[model samples]
Target: MRSIGLILLLCTSLDSYKILIYNSKYGHSHSNFLGSIADALVDAGHDVTSLIPVMNPKLKDGTENSKIIRIEPDQQVLDSYAKEKENYNYFELNSFNPLIAIFMGPKFPKKFEYVCRKVLDEPGLIDRLKAEHFDVYISENFDVCGTALAHAIAPKTMIGSYSSALTGQHFSEFGVPEAISYRPAAYMTSLDVHSMVDRAWNFYASLHHKYCFWFLRLSINRLMKERFGEEYPSVAEQSANVAYVLTNSEPLIEFAAPTMARVINVPGIGAKTPKPLDEYWSEVMTRRDQTILLSFGSVVKSIQLHPAVKAAIVKTISRFPSITFIWKYEEPDDEFAKEAAAKLPNLVLTKWMPQLDILAHPRLYVFITHGGMGSTQETALRGVPGIFVPIFGDQMKNAGMMEYNGFGKVFDKNNLGDADKLTATIKEVLENKKYRENAQRISKMLAKKPFSSKEQLVKYVEFAAEFGASAALRPQSVDMSFVTYHNLDVILASAACIFIFVYLICKMCSRTAVKLVALISGKTKNE
Candidate 1:
C-alpha cells in the first residue's frame, strides 16, 4: 500500500511543469494578460516564473508556486521614454495611419534589444534561468526579445506567443490565410464591408504590414547576432518554431477571419471577475443619481489631454449636472486638471479607479473610453455601452468595431474641442435605448462559448507542454516560396502555353493562304 501511494505521488509530481512567461512591454494591459495566464497555471498546480518589465505594476496576488522577475529598463531608455511622453502630441495624426504606424513598428525592436541587454547585464541572471529548466516558454508576440530570451535560456522548451489581437501578417508568416478583402487591419478604422475602395485600402494595408514585420524581424536578427553571436536563430525562425499562438480577440468583436488550428482566440483573458466595489467607491456610486466612468486606459491619461480638449470635456460634462462623471486622471496633482475637475459639482477626478469594478456597477450608466481592446472587451463583458474617442494604435479599429456592433458611438478626438458636438453626441448615446440593448446582446453572445477563455487557454497550454512542438499542424504552405504558394508559376505557365498554341495556328493559316494565292496565279498564267 505504501509503495502504491508513493508511485501515485510521483506520477502527480511528474505532471506538474515549470513554465516561464516573458512580457517586457511596459503597458499594463499586456502585463495583465500574461499575469492572468500565470495565475491560471499556478492554480492548475504548475510552477510559473514571469519576467516582466519593472515599469508595470505588480500583479494583484501570487501563489507560492509562482515567481515574478521584474526586468528594469536601462537608464537611457527610461530617460528617453520620459522625454518622449512629455513631448508627445496625441493629435499629430488624424487617425491611426497605417503608413505612419508601419514605419514606427521597427523602432520597437531597438527598445526590446535594450531591455534584453539590461537583463544580460544583471549578475548571474542568465545562469539562474538556465538552472530552472523551464518546460515551456510563453512570450508576448509584440516584442522580439521575449522569443530571443526563450531561445537563449531554454532552447528545448516548447514556445508559444500571446498577442492582444490577430496580427494578420504575423499569422501569415505561419501560413495562416488572411481575409484582407473583407477583414480590416487592426490599425484600420474601416468596417468589414468590402467596397472596391475598402478592398484597395485593405490590400495596401496588408502589404504595409508585411513590410513592417519583415523589417522588425531583420532588426531583431541583427541585434541578436550582435549580442549572442552569429549562430543564434533569427526572430523569424524562432517564431516559426512556436507551437501555439493565443490571441485576445474573438470573431464577435474581431472581423471574421479564418485562423490556423494552432491559433487560439481567448478574447476576455484580461477581464477579471467583477468583484464588489470597495466601500468608498460603492458609496460614491450609490450617492450619484447617474454615473459615467471616463477612462482613456493606462497608457494615455486624462491629464495628458490638450488644454483646449480638457476644457471642452469639462464644459460638456458640466452641462449634465444630474450625472456624475468619474475621470481616471493619472496626474490628479496637476493644477489645471484639478481646476477643471472643480468646475463641475458632479465631476470626480482620481489618479486611479477600479475600472472593471466600476463597469460592473449597477448604477453606472455608460463608459467613456479610448476604445482600447482591454477596455472594449471589459465593457462588452459587463454589458455596458460606450462613447469611444479613439486616439491611436488599434483604438481606432476597436472603436469602429464597437460602433458597428451597435454597442458604442465613436467621436473623433480632433472634434473634442467642439463642445456642442461632443455634448450632443454624449447625450444622444445616453438617451438611446438601443445601444444598451445591443451591448447586452453582445455580452450574451460572448458568454455563449463552450469553454471559458481561461479554460481553453490552460488546456491548450498544457497540451503544448506535454507534446513538444506541433510541427505536423503547420501547413505545407509555410515551407513554399511566395510565388509557388500563390500558384503564380502555374498561372504563368498556362498563359505561355496558350500563347504558343495561338502562334502555331496563325503560322499555319498564313502558309495555307500563300499556297492558295500561288495556285490562283498559276491558273491565270495557263489561261
Candidate 2:
C-alpha cells in the first residue's frame, strides 16, 4: 500500500504543468474564448496564469488554484485607441469596393501596431512574465504582439488560438492548401458550388488576403525591430515557431479547406451550457407563446441603432402581437427605447440577458442576430433558425452560410429602414419548415462528433506541451519558399519545356519538307 501511494503521487506530479495565456483583445467574445481555455486548463490539473488587457470584460477572479493578471496600458493611449476602434467602419470591407481597401488598409496596420506597443509597455509586465517559467504559451492570433510576447518569454511550446471561423489566407501561412476554388473567404458570401465568375472573385480575394497580411507582417517586423532592438527576430519568425493552432470552427458548417494536422477545430469552446432562467425572466418567457431574441452582438449596441431603423423594427415586430420579442438592448435607460417598449405589450427591453440560456429555452422560435461567429455557433448549437443582419467583417459571410445551409435568411442592413421587407423576411423564416428542419439537422450532425470541443482542446493542448513540437505534424511545405510552395516555379518550368519541345517539332517538320522539295526539283531537272 505504501509503494502504490508513492507511485500515484509520482504520476500526479508528472502530469502537472504550468501554462500562460495571453488575450489582449477587449471584445467580449474574444475574451470568452481565452477564458474558456484557461478554465479548461485549470480543470485538467494544470496551473494557468492568464494575462489580459485591463479594458476587457472582467473575468472570474483567481482562486488559490489559478491566477489572472490584468495589464493596464497608458490611460490616454488606451482611450484614444478605444475611440478610434469604436469609430472604425468594419463594414467597408464588404462593400466590394476596391477604393475602400485603399483607404483602410494602411490605417489598420498602424492602429494594430499602436495597440500592440501599448499592451507590451505595461509596467512590471515583462518582469512578471520572466518569473513564471510557463511550460506553454497560448494566445489569441489576432494580435501579432501576443506572438512576440511568447517569443520574448521563451516558453517550451507555443499555441495560437483563432476565435473566428477559418480564413483561407490564414491556412496558407502555415502551408495548408486553401482550396480557394471552392472554399470561400470568411468575409465572402460565395458558395461551394460556384460559377466561373465566383471562382475568379474567390481567387482574387485569396490573393488580396495574402498580400495584405504580407504587408502587415512587414510593418510589424519593422516595429518590433525598432522596439526590441535589431537582434530580435521578426513577428513572422515568432509566428512560425507556433506549434499548434486551435480554430473555432466545425467542419459540418464551414466550407471545406485543407488544414495542417496541428490545426485543431474546437468549435464553440466558450459556449455555456443551458441554465435555468431567473424567476422573473422565466415567468416572462412562460407568459409568451413564442419568443424571438434580437441582439446585434456585443460590439454593436442596440441603443445606437439609427432611429429610422429602430422604428422600422418596432413597426415590423408590432404586426405580430401574439409573438414576444426579447431585445438585448444595451441601454435600458434610453428614453426613446423605454417609451417604445411601454407602447408594445409584447416587447421586453433588457440591458443584460443570459444569451445562451435564452436561446436554449423551449419558447425560443427564432434568433435575429448580427451574425457574429460566437452568436452564429451558439444558435446552431441550439438548433434555432436565425434572421441575420450582418454589419461587418465575417458577419456577412456567416450570414451567407446560414442562408446557404437553409437554416435562415440574410436581411440587408441597408434595408433596415424598410418595415415591409423586414416583416416579410421575419414572416418567411417563421413560416418556413425547411429552415427549422435544416437547423435541427446541423445540430444533430454536430452532436454526433466523437468528442466534445472541450475534450479535443484539452487533449491537443496537453499533447503540444508534452511533445514540445511534432516534427511530423509540421509539413515540408513550411520550409519551401513562396515560389516553390505555390508551385509557380514548377508551372513556369513546365511551360518552358513544352515551348521548347513544340519549337523543335516544328523545325524538324520544316527541314523534312525542304529536303523533299529539293529532291523533286533535282528529279525534274534530270528529266
RMSD of each: 3.0, 2.9
- lDDT value, residue 127 of candidate 1: 84
- Residue 13 in candidate 2 has what lDDT? 76
Inter-residue clash pairs, candidate 2: none
Q: How accurate is candidate 1 locally (lDDT)?
A: 0.77
Against the reference, the lDDT scores of all candidates come to: 0.77, 0.77
Best by lDDT: 2
Q: For candidate 2, lDDT tens digit of each residue in 407-471?
A: 79988888878999999999999998999999999998888888999899888888888888777
Tens-digit lDDT track for model 1 on 177-244?
Answer: 77777777765676546378777776776676666666556776787788789999876667777788
By TM-score, who's the top model here? 2
